[model samples]
Target: MMSALVLYVTDDCSLCDQALELMAAAGAPDFQSVFIDDVPALQTTYGWRVPVVHDGHRGRELDWPFDVAALRAFLQPG
Candidate 1:
C-alpha cells in the first residue's frame, strides 16, 4: 500500500477537532498532524483553512470537510 500522511493543519481550531472526528469516522488513514502555527509557510498558505490531508510521496494535498466517499477516493490505489 502507498504511504500517505493526512495533515490536520490548524491552530486551536474547534473545526479541526470536528474534522478529526469526521476523519476518524471516515476511517481515514494514519497521518501526521501538523499545526499551522508550528510552521510559518503552512500558516501563511492555509490561513483559516484547517484540516487538510496530504500525500507525502506525491506531494498532493486534499482539503478537509470531506465525506467518506471523498476519503475513499483519495485513498484509492494508484
Candidate 2:
C-alpha cells in the first residue's frame, strides 16, 4: 500500500522535477503524486508551493529547499 506521504506538484515545473530527483536520490518511500493543476482545491492550496511534501498521516508539511537529510527526517515515523 502507498504511504500517506504526498508530493504536491504541477505540470511543466522544473523545481518539481528536481524534487522528483531528490526523492529518488533520498530513496524515499512510496508516495502519492498529486497534480495540483488537476485539482482546484490543490491548485489553490499549492499554486506557488508545487514542491511541497505532505505527510497526511501526521498532518505535517515539508516545503521546498529540503535536502536528502531533511527528506529522511520527514519520512521517519512520528
Model 1 clash pairs are none
Overall lDDT per candidate, in order of appearance: 0.73, 0.89
lDDT of 1 by residue, 11-63 (tens): 67877787777678777777777787878888788766677888887787778
Task: Write down the worst ten-residue block by lDDT for model 1.
Answer: 1-10
Backbone clash total for model 1 is 0
- Candidate 2 Cα RMSD (Å): 1.2
For candidate 1, the TM-score is 0.77
Clashes of each: 0, 0
TM-scores of all predicted structures: 0.77, 0.90
Q: Residue-wise lDDT of candidate 2 within 1-78, one digit each (tens)?
A: 777989999899999999989999889988988888878888889998879999988999999989889998888886
